[model samples]
Structure formats: structure tokens, C-alpha cells
Target: MGFDFLEWLNLAARWLHLITGIAWIGSSFYFVWLDNNLERPGSDAEAAGVSGQLWSVHGGGFYHNQKYPVGPGQLPRNLHWFKYEAYFTWLSGFSLLVLVYYVGARSFLIDPAKAALEVDDATALGITSLIVSWLFYHNACRLLARWPLALGIVWFGYLVGAAAFLESVFASRGAYLHVGAIIGTAMVGNVFFVIIPNQRKVVAAIKAGEAVDPKLGAQGKQRSVHNNYMTLPVLLIMISHHYPMTYGAQRPWLVLALLGATGIAIRHIFNVRHRNGPTGRWIALAVVLALVSVTYVSMEKSGAPAAQASVDPDAISFADVQPIIEQHCTSCHAEQPTSELFSEPPLGLKLENFEEVHAASTKVKQMAVDSDAMPLGNMTGMTDEERATLGAWIDAGDPE
Candidate 1:
């Protein structure tokens, strides 16, 4: 309960982590949107053959922006580098990964049923996957930067491979979170190695009054674009652990596929808009509807038995069901629950008395049986028999 030295350090780092990450992602997305929205400048020989262009005003100031598929004509002195935000975010996030998932693997990261990995193995898998993902992506980008279709095919195949990997080695929660962490790592690595170094060379060439090599600029742009596409999905996956069905379903990998695909499809619409082309609103809508449909599939599958056998009606309902709700569920689900854990009832579902409990019977069944939040099992104690009682109530129809 008390904060130790390392725990305090982690708390401080986490604050830094979120702030910097938002700055990095916000700027990146803004630029992409701006480049798509910019107008072609008059007398623009240097800006010919650009990806996209835009003009903007912010903070009582106006600015013009352009995307040169070839390198910029000149480099300005004292140019700011947008690299550290990506770097610090990755650094603090790694610290959090160690503090939360590695330290509490059984509850947060590990699933014994999925793999025989001990805590160390899971930790290694998580860390190694982060590094290797960057390697895979960077190499793939290098190999296919000139061939856009080839790059797309390779990236799509990589995602399918990642989905299969998630289903195989780690629990869905661990698997999906780790995959996002990998993407996060790749994004920062681009900032650190490829994009920054390439920018340095191109800037130096321009400063020397020499023509910048277009290839370096092209390579950097490619990596940066990949980071742009992945930003939304990584954000979604990073926070998804809090939602039960998102990362804790029977076919959780399928949910992951849909989430990633939706992120890509939405970004594709923006990319189209950026190019001064027709908006792909239909693609974005289709992606969202597809995500909803995929979620329904997981929900339908969740009600199926996670356990082997069914509970008896009379023995379970009469004796176990009502009492278990009072002891464990009511603490958090009551108007004035005596449980110190929650000050207010969650989801506004009350289970203070027999009638209130019956009225919320459906909610209780879903939360207790389908999700893991009712008794705050991860944060507190919930006996196996107590969980069984709640599960039995759901298995046996609610009969007053």
C-alpha cells in the first residue's frame, strides 16, 4: 500500500511518459493533416513533385507547409528536432512495463494456460518483441520503400503473423499490449535512428549549399508515414486492457485484428484527404461498422462456457447465488457499500437488498461470470467458491 522508492520513481516517470507521448503523436498527426490540406504555392519550383501541401494559422500566427517527395531546397539554422518526445515516451513506457506487467505477471501479463513461460520468459518475450519489431519494420521499409505495393503487402503479412503470435504465446491481454508496445518502440526508433540521422545528412548538405540527396529524405518520409499510420492503433491497444472483452475474449486476437484494421482504414481516409484527393469517408465508416460487428462476435462467444460443467439450479440459486452477491458483489455494487474499496456503486447498479439484487440480476451475471471486475479480484481477494457461486447464478436462469 505504501510507496517504495522504485514505485515513486515509476509514478513520476509515468507522468512524463503521457505528456511527451501526447506531444509527439499530436504533432505528427497534425502535420499529416496539414500536408494534406495545404495549397500549392506560387513560383514553387523547389516544391514541385510534393506528396501534399497545406497552410495553417495557430496561436495568432500563420504558416505555410509543403511536403517535398524530393528533399527540401534549403535547411534553416537552429531547426528544432521533434525526436525527444518519441524517445522519452518509449523510455518511460518501458519503465512502466517493468513496474506493472513484469512485476505482476500472474495478474497482468501471464496466462499459464497459454504458455509454460515463467515470469522471466514472459518478460524476455515482451522486451525482445519490442526490439525485433522495429528491426522487422525498418528492414521491411528499407527493402520496399520504392515499391509501395510491396511494402503494403509485407506490412499486412507482418500484422497477420503478429495476430497469430498473440494467440500462441501470451494471454490475449499480454499479447495485444505487447504488440502495441512493439509498434510504439518502432515509432520511437524511427525518430532515434532512421529519420533523425537522415534529416541530419540532408540538413548538412543543404547548409553547405549542396543539393540534398533525395533518397535520404524519401527513406525518412517513409518511416515517418508508417509511424503516422500506426499511432491510432497503438493508442487504442495501450488502453484496451481496462476493457474486459477487448483483450480478454476467447478469440481476442480476432478483436485485435479488427482494431488494427480500423485504425489503418481510418488513417487511409486521412491520407486520401491529405493528397488533395476525394475523401474516403466510406472506407472509414466501413471500418468502424466492421469493428462493431467484430465486437459483437466476441460478445456472443463470451456467453459460452469458459468452464467445463454447468451448475445445478436449486442448489446454486437458493443457497449460493444470493449470498455471494451480498458478500462480494454488494460491497462495490450497493448504494452505501460497506466495502472500503469503492465509495460509489459502479455502473449505478445496486445490489443492497433482494429486490435490487434481482433487478440487477442480468448485470451481475455478466460482470461476475463474463468479466473479472466484480469483486476487484486483481486488487483484492475473491475466494474460488465465491466466484463459483456467481458463475452458477449466471449458468442457472434467474428465478425468484
Candidate 2:
């Protein structure tokens, strides 16, 4: 019944981040869809500077929308800006990042097996990655403004490289989240530095009755498109920690890259469909990439079979894993967790007894056996033999 201030704060920040992120991404997607669906304006509307128009019915009402390629003949008195959603999403997301990963660095961020980083060093490296990723992406966009294909290829390569570097330095889950953070930072940066500013300039020009620069609008649209394509990948990374098969793979960076490509391919399918273009090829590509990713992760690790084969399922029992679970898992997965990192069992999964462990056998197999994702940062130093034993117990149908 006592107040857990930090936990509440984490909840608040995460909720706010989700709300604002949905708003930002929703508006971005709506506009992209609107742009793609617009038809040529009628002669009178075209004469009044309207380039395209769309008519739709929704929620028992009809709505007509028009797009002006540059600016309207006159600025509207009550123009609404969509920049705050992007800004607040980033702010709330960063706050959650600080609360969870930065404040709990030793528990969440650092993997002693990966690198021996002090809390300050880990936090600094994470922050630096965000800044440097944005700088590199922004400059790449600018330098290759005329060659979008080249820019996309280069930027994706940079992201894969960043993922590799982060995986080398942080815990796998932490590295995955940081990669997400980098993408989120760049997305909000687009809004703050390029999209909103260019939009303001357009508004100012309209107010002063000056000719609006078409290039300004073009540049903003380009960035907006980039953000739209990135939305799915960011969403996947946001929820990735809950599924260790992604970040816990032998080559997590490659897993990330393949999954990221899958997301992009799926997003491209939607984009093509919005434009009423053929989506068959993109859909095929997305399915193939997704299958490859799942198959790769499900493949046994290089040395896993030796340890797994050593444990006979017919001989292993729940009692065999009871000690392993108590020593390595119950610290964070008990009714009253002993670990300082949790005031309550994570995900409300308590393994203090055989029944509880039996009920969660699949999850245990997934987190601790299929991937060495449990023991969070390997804090209690759970061994390969211990995981193999757990796997064997599960395979034995959790024998008593």
C-alpha cells in the first residue's frame, strides 16, 4: 500500500510516450494516405491554388479535403500545428529511457559478459549514439538529396552498424532499445529541425503575400515520407524486450537488421496499396524476410546441442530445475522479489514453487532456454548447463 514513486513515474512516462507516439504516427500516416489518395482538383479549385482534392464519407458524415501543392492563397486564421505530438512523444520516450535504463543501468543496461562499463560510461555512450545517429542521418539526407535510393541504402547500413556497436557494448535488450531510441531521436529531429521550420517559413511567406518556395515543401514531404516508413520498425523495437528471441539471438545485430528490413517491406506494402499500386511483390518480400528471421532465431545456437543432448528429458524433472530457478530466476520472479531491481515479480510471474514454474514452462523455455535472455544481464551468472536442464524439464512435460 506504500507509494512506489519511481514505478509510478515509469508508468506515467511510458503511457504518455505511447499516447503521443500514436498521435504523431497516426497523423503522419493519415497525411501520407491523404497525399496518395488525392485526385486532381477541379478547374475552379485549381485556379484558387488547390492542387488536389479527395472526398470521403466516415462516421455518418462526408468530408472533403484539398491539398495545395505549396500554400493556400491566404493563410488560415486557425492553423493547427502537428509538431507538439512529435515533440512530446520524444520527450516522454526519453524520460522513460532515463528512468528504466539509465537509472537502473547495472540491472538493465550493462552486461558484464559484453563489456565492463561504469554506469556513467554506459549512459554517456547511449546518449552519444542518439546524437551521432541523428547527425549522420541528417547529413546523409542532405548530401544525397537528389539520390534517395543511395541515401536509404547508406542510412540503413549506418543503422546496422550502430546496432552492431551497441550490441557489443550493452546488454542485448539494452542494445535493442538503444537502436530504437536512435531511430526515435532521428524521427523527432526531422520534425523539430526540418519539417516544422520549413512549414513555419511557408506560413510566414503566405502571411506576407510572398511566393512560397516549393523546395521547402518538397523537403518537408521527403522527411515526412521517411518518418512514415520508419514507424513500423520503431514499433517493433519498442516491444522487442518482451520477446528475447529477437535480441537474444546469437547475432542480435543481424537479427535486428533482418527484422528491420521485414518491417520496412511491410510498410512499403501499405504505402503501395495507399497509392493504388501493385503490392504483390512487397507482400512476398515481407513474408519471406519474416520467415527467415523467425527461422534464424529458432535455429539452435552453435554449442547448444551439446549441452541440450547431455540432459536427458526422460531423466530430468521439475526438481532438477527447482534449484536453478530459485538461484537465478526467483530473485526477480517471486511474490516478494529479493532483487532491488523489482518491488514485485516481473510480469507477475512467480516461480517459487513447482506448479508456478510448470505453468510458465513455455516462457521459461523461451527466455532462459531458447535464448539466454533471462537472469537479466546474466546478473546471477546462470550457466549453459542450468538452461539446458530447464529445457530438458520442459521437454519432459514438467515432470514432478
Candidate 3:
């Protein structure tokens, strides 16, 4: 139950990540709709390829907005950078990812049966893939963006490749977790590399009263758009671990891909919502149901889909884990654990027998995972040795 400084820091990071992600995503989605809905004003200013305009009331004030194809002229001296939300959101998210998944990877990421590597190797591969993914994506964006649909083709190939690689080497959980990390890394890098630099250059031009190049803005916008498309999927990735129902299933990577695609498509519905209203609503719903169908269809995969990894009651024996559990865990886990002075199982958990033990392997793994609570009050002074025995038991195919 007691937590160290780093564990506490992780808690704080998760809180901040959620707060800032909401703000960032809210603004991003809002701006997309705003851009789509702005009305065209055929004035002299309209000759400059200005597509639309809008008037709004908020905070007891009226606001007017305009859309220029690119640069209208020199940038404003009072430019407010919209880059911080992207940066802070990514920063807190990265910290949480490192804390929950990386540092705790032995408990969270490694799958011995699936991949015979130490925690360090899994962590290394995760980090390397994330960094390399960004580099590959950035370069490919710049290089092939001219071909119009090149981004889609490359993205599709990369997604399929990533799913295949993950399925080959790691368990379903490991593969999906890494996908989110990949996208999160790319989002942060977009801020530190492309978005910020271009904004700085544009600001410099504005300060010098020189003409701001339109291409700079275009490049930054393109990257931002990419981030927008990624937002929904990254969110699913972040929370996937908590839902064993999703990542624990068979063919989890396939689930990840379909869910991710649905995210992108759903974003388009919102992107055009302001312009098309109810029509856009249908598109978003259609994609959502299609995604649900993907998951449902996979469920009919003859019992080997990702999640039914077998609840073989015989697999995880009560003997190996029971004594260890009783020694440390039963103090609080029992119907009335003498160690904790409780009248009932802490979370109504009764790991008192083989049945209870196998049924709660997922919960056991989760608790043993973060060391959130067990051996209530450390009454029996459960050592790391005992924790490992329990964790590894679950990881070892949770065999009986």
C-alpha cells in the first residue's frame, strides 16, 4: 500500500496528463470545426484566397475570425503560440508511459512465453521503436507528401507492419501498449521539432516586419493535422491496459488496427461536423459501428481470439501460489485476514482456494503489477522474492 517517490510522481504525471490532454484535444477539435464552418465573405480581402469568416460570442464578447489560404502577410507581433498544449500534454503522457509501462515493465510489458527476453530488452525495443517510428514518419511525411495520397498508403503499410511485428514477438497486451507509445512520441516530437521551429521563424519574420513565408505555416499545419488524427487512438492506447477485455484478447493487434482506423475516421466526422451537421454525425456513427463489428466478428474466431487465453482452472494451481498468497496476501485477502484486522476480503477478493486464485489472475497481475496493495500492511513482510513468485506465476501462462 505504501508508495515510493517515483510511484507518487507517476500518479501526479497521470493527473496532469489527463487535464492537459482534454484542453489540447478540445482546442484541436474545436479549431478543425471552426475552420470548416467559417463563411466566405466576398470582399476585397476575399481576393487573397480567404475562404471563410465567422462571428462568435463567448465570455460576453463578440469575436470575428477569418481564414486565409496561407499567410495573409507578415505574422502578428502579438502571436500566441498554440504549441504548449501539444508539448505539455505529450510531456506528462510520456512521463506516465515511462513510469507505468517502462519502469514497471517486468510486471507490465514482458511476456516470457511470447518473447524470451529480459525486461531491459523489452524496454529498449519499445523505446527504439518509438523513436524510430517518429523519424520514419517525419521523413516520409516530408518526402512523399507531394504524392497526395502517399501518407495514407505509407501509414496503412506501417500500421500493418507494426501489428504483424507486435503479434509475432509479444503478447497482445505488449503490442497494443507500444502502439500508443509510438504515437505519443511522435506527437511530442512534432512540437519540439517541426511546430515550434516553424513558429519561431514566423515570429522572427513578424518582428523584423518582413514577409512571412506561407510554406512554413503550411508545414506546421500539416503536422498538427497528423497529431489531430492520432489523438483518439492514442487515448485508447493509454487506457487499454486497464481493460483486460480489449488487450488480453487474441489477435489484439488486429483489434488495435481497427480501433485506430475508427479513431481516424471518427475524427473526419467531427472535422466536417460544423459544415455538414447531422450528415457528419452519420459518418462518425457508421465508423463506430464498423469498429464494433470488427471486434464482434473477431470474437467468433473459434475460441482462440486474444482474450480467451484460457481460463483453464487447472492451469494456475492453488498450491504454488496459495501458500505464497496466504503468507503475504491472505492477511488482508482472507475472509478475515488476521494480519489486517479486516472482516472481509479487501476488495471482496477471496484468494482462499484454487478457484478464487485462477478467477482473479488478472486482478492479481494488476495488483502485483504496481504493488498497489497486497500482504495488507506488509504484515507478513512480503519480500520482493514473494512478489516475483506471484508475478511470474501469472506471467508463466498462469499454469496450475
Candidate 4:
């Protein structure tokens, strides 16, 4: 079957995923902001069981909103649930993951260098990991309910551990994406299993004129808080697949931890600012410094110095490097890739000749030498020795 149709389908799924994700995130942010900015209502509102109220201006109109810990004495005639957005975001994202990674497992999922995984084994691992991670997370939240500091330490430590475990099992892109998938699963699971159910129970209890469980509301809020803190880190993981420096590092797990920490710190700054707290700016400064450090560390670690000295430019020729590129790289980096996956050279890069190869010398070196991110899961049978030779050739200034 032609991948063209599949490509179009994948595009549609990804588009829907992004659109729904934005809707969900916007609602989350707005609600969090509302909660933080709300003021205790006056006697009249308090008598009506209104706990808090807020006034705002949007779209050239003044608006007022109120919150009730239980219910506003009665249910609204019309209620809008911010749920399909979360549901569809996860559904489409998982569909896209299946299409791009699971369906094309050999090309995008397994790295022989990382682990010798058959396609079935890899697919099983991916699915199992997502399920297991969510189970562990849900239980951890329950167990650590009383101590948020302990819960946070466990949560962050789990991410670090998951990063390390995944990096060992899959290719750079695959490892990063699986981590994202696990986190996304946990977020959606929070909405499905904890948040929405509690909300439904409250609504039903209010309608039935019974005492609503305060614990349900508290649990729902706790899940919401977890989702809020995870937003930035999940976003970073989602976008990490696009950047090789993040996924392609020697210690990609450490890179993941550093970046995730930076994201969390930045998120904390925003959360604090929304609450009119003073430490937000200091936290923002720390985030900036952390980002700089991450970049420096990624670069240094990704391009460890070659044990052998640089080759002599005068002694090397294009012929020495041509065979390796032609054998392993040109399949996907040429004007007409032999692989069915590409209609043209990926990233508009063509390596059909010495000139084209020389022009992209740095990129070639980065992909093959600095990191084994090329050959797309090493599908073209690229060897470490071949990568070393390509690095040496680039270091020798691409002699004709």
C-alpha cells in the first residue's frame, strides 16, 4: 500500500490532535486563573452557597463568574463539559502514534544499537509501558495524597527513571515519544477516571438533593493540580521528537530530566504569578539559566571528541566517503529516495553528488558522527565504523 494515503490520514489526525489539545489547555489555564483570582463573595452570594466570585472583561464585555464548593443550590439549565477536547486529543494522538511508529515500527521504533527488539516486541512494550505507567501514577497519587512534597519527588523521580528505561529500549525519537505517550496517557486517565467521575458524582448528588461528598471534590481538585503541573513538561516531551539534540544525546535520559525540570520550573513561575506570588521572577530567571545549561550540556555530550585524530584533507577524497553515504544515507537523502516513505529528499536535503554532500557536511557529521540519529532507526545498516569514517571525512574538509 502507498504511504501517501497513510501520510494524509496521519496529517489529519495530528491536526485534530493539536486543535483539541489547544482547546483543552486553554480551558485548563482559564479555570486555574479563575480559581486563583476569585474573591470571597459577599453576604448575599455566601447565603446562596457561592464560595467565590470573579469579575473580568473579555471581547469588549464585562463578565462575572461564581464558584460553589458543592452546587449553586441547583444545577444550571445548560452545562458545558470540557471533556471531549481531552478525550479527542488523546484519541487522535494515540492514532497518530500507531500510524507513524507502530505501523512503521522498523523504521521509527527500534534501534538495534539501543536494543535488539523485534517489531512485535517493541509494539507490546510501548502499549504495556503506557498502561503500567498510568497504573503506577494513579496509585502513587493515592498513596502520597497527604504529602505533596513526597508525591512530587516520586513523580519527578519516576520520569527520570522512565526516561532512562525508554532510552535503553528504543531509538532516540521512539524513546522520547514513548515517554510523552505515557505522560499523555496519565493526563487523559486523570480526566477520565478521576476528574470527570468525581464531577459527575457531585452533579448527581446535587440533583438528588443529598449531601455531596467533599472528598470527591477534593480528589478532583488534586488531579487537576497534577494535570496543571504536568502541562509544561508534557509539552516539552511532545515537541522533543523534532529536535535531535534532545533525543539524540549520549545520555538522553539526563537531557530529558534537565529539560523537564526547566519546563516545570517555568511552569511554577507562571502558576505563582497567577496567584500574585513574589517568587515567580526568581523562578523564571532560574529557568532561563537552566535552559542555557541544558543547551551547553547537550552539545558537549552529543559531540564527544573522537578518539582518533582528524584525517588529513589532502589525503582524503570524496570516493572514500561516497560509498558510505550512498550505501546508508542517500536512500532517504537523495533527489529520489529509494524508500517508499519519501517523495523527495527529507528536509529538502539531497546528497546525490559530491557538491551536495560537501554543502551539507556539517549536518551529515551531526547526524552520523555526533549521533546515530540518521538512517532512521539505522534501517540502512549503517555501521559505527562507517559513521566514524564519515566524521573523519567531514573533519578533513570534504576533499574532492
Best by TM-score: 2
**Which sections of candidate 1 miss by over 4 Å?**
4-7, 44-53, 66-74, 280-285, 288-368, 371-400
- Judged by lDDT, which candidate is best? 2
Q: How close is candidate 4 to the true structure, as a TM-score?
A: 0.92
Candidates 2 and 3 compared: the better one by TM-score is 2
Ranking under TM-score, best-scoring first? 2, 4, 1, 3
Alpha-carbon RMSD, candidate 1: 5.1
Q: Any residue pairs clashing in model 1, and if so which? A: 36-274, 38-53, 38-54
Q: Model 3 over residues 342-392: C-alpha lDDT tens digits?
A: 445655888877778778987887655324234322335556556656766
Weakest 10 consecutive residues, lDDT, candidate 4?
Answer: 305-314
Better of 3 and 4 by lDDT: 4
Candidate 3 residue 168 Cα shift, in angstroms, is: 3.1
Candidate 3 has its poorest 10 consecutive residues by lDDT at 305-314
Tens-place lDDT per residue, model 4, 1-400, is 3357876898899999999999988998888888888899999999999889999998999999999987767899998888899999999999988998899889999888778889999999999999989999999999999998899889889988988998888887888888888888988999999999999999999899999888998898888878887888889888876667778777888888877777777777777887888975768676785877577776776568654423454576888888888898888887778887776787899998999999999888877777778889988887777777787788777778
- Give per-model TM-scores: 0.78, 0.97, 0.74, 0.92
Angstrom error at residue 200, model 4: 0.8
Candidates ranked by lDDT = 2, 4, 1, 3
TM-score of 1: 0.78
